[model samples]
Target: MQFDLNRITRKNIQLLKPYSSARDEFSGEAKVFLDANENSLGSPLTKWYNRYPDPHHVQLRNKIAAIKGIAPEHIFLGNGSDECIDVLFRCFCEPGVSNTIICPPTYGMYQVSANINNVAIQEAPLLPDYQLNLAHIEQLVNADSRIIWLCSPNNPTGNLMNLEDIETVLNNFFGLVVVDEAYINFARQRSLISLLPDYPNLVVLQTLSKAWGLAGLRIGMAFAGMAIVEIMNKVKPPYNISEPAQELALKALDEVGQVNDMITLLVDMREALAAVFRQMPWVEVVYPSDANFLLVKMQQAHLVYEFLLDKGIVVRDRSRVELCDNCLRITIGTEQENTLLVDALAAWHEQ
Candidate 1:
């Protein structure tokens, strides 16, 4: 279908003249700097952090573009994907008027962000198989529906949403389609990032927190058409990502091979953990996962969750979530951690 970004983008945002920083206007290395009002005497910490970081994140975006096969202009790096998510609400959804649709038993942040922005959120719960309910989604969409959030290899569910269903939404929906791939590194399916060229309204988000082991760094990626990226940049803080985050992200990019090896190990561990869970009579279901975690349906899930907690073992109790009754979301931990969890469950079963 025809996707006109102007139709959904907030009128005030379209006319907004974003705040420009000193670094935004200048480039090239300099020996003595006296630009944006700094201490100039250098910071107390080793290595000068006296100056503000590059607001545009030039080097980080270029490195990411080279790896992802997208232009730097198409990338918008946020403090975390949360920033990008919030900015989208600010840029498109008009508070108390324009609304967004989200598939439930998915991520919670989408709903939280919508609430914070005062945008109405329409719920289209996933099918029993944990796939998109496209018909319901279509019925929910209206003139004021500005965005639709889909989480593949979905959180707490640990399964990828069917691609055909996603494509159908993109092909039919006039509003933007945001596909969050936070756990894509562990998934077998290819990222929808490659399809950005084919779908102008598509926005794919990924993060460094999971596979890269950089949760502390808090850098997230948003890949889209240059138009979307530019709009996001306009709405984002001038210096959202810190200097340390940019430096570490660049270093992590250099070690892609190491990251790949870690992913392979985690996938193996995920399957191994699933195998062990299947043997337990108490485990009613060990849902197949394209993620680094598993959603296990157990008998007396609340009791089991408490038992594990009492043993100093932690797992999310998602039994109250719709369609995930009696379920606990378990992360693929190290071998020792996994052994501890398994042993704890075994002991509980014995009792």
Candidate 2:
């Protein structure tokens, strides 16, 4: 389909005059730094955090762009992927008017963000096998649907959405196709960030929380066309990302090799743990995962969840989630932690 960004972007967002901060007014080295009414004497703890963070995360975005082989102009950083999700809604979906499509048994934040923005949500629930129901998705698309949320190596289920199916939607959909790859670091399929240049409507969301071990930092990324990035930046809080988060994320980006090593170890552990679950009598099915987690369909799944909780262990009880009845989602933990889980399961079985 011929994509016209201006046509798809919300009218109010199109006319938006973004807030310009002191940093936005001036960039580069300065001596006195008498701008933005800072403490100037520095914070109670350290002088370093006295100044506000860069409203435009130049250094962090450039570093990430280098790593991801995308232009910094294409990147938009948020407090986390959730912020990115909210910003997308703010930028495109008009509240109580425009809508977005979501494939459920996917990320919860999509629906949550849509609700928070008062934007209508159209659900195209994933098929029984936990992949997109493309026909259902197509049927739901209309003039008002501004975004379609797809989570790869999807949460709860832990499997990647079929790449071709994603491309098909991208090919046909007139609005934004946001493929959230928060767990892409563990997945075998290549990120759709590479396809950004080809598809102006594609927005790829990723995070440092998972494989980078920076959930505490809360740095989330959105890669899209420069137009989309600009609009998102326009709507986002000027100093959304914190000083320490930007610094820590920059440092973490430098250690790609270390992160990859951890990913390799985690993927190995994930497979090993899945194997153990498969052999367990309580596990009815251990769904194949391209993510760092496994979704195990268990007999008495909620009871197993409670039993594990009693044992001081916790895993997501997705038994009530659509298409996930009697299932528990378990993240791949450290070797000792995995063993502890297995031992706990064995103990529960013995009971």
Best by lDDT: 1
Per-model TM-score versus the true fold: 0.98, 0.98
Going through the candidates in order, what is the number of backbone clashes in each? 0, 0
True-vs-predicted CA distance for residue 137, candidate 1, Å: 0.3
Clashing pairs in model 2, backbone N/Cα/C closer than 3 A: none
Tens-place lDDT digits, model 2, residues 1-351: 477898888888899899989898877798888888988877678445988899999999999999999899999999999999999999888898998999988889999999999999899999999889999999999888899999998998999999999999999999999999999999999999999889989999999889899999999999999989999999999999999999989998999999999999999999999999999987899999999999999999999999999999999999999899999999999999999999999999999
List RMSD in Å for every model shown. 1.1, 1.0
Span of ten consecutive residues with least summed lDDT in model 2: 39-48
User: Per-model C-alpha lDDT, please?
Assistant: 0.93, 0.93
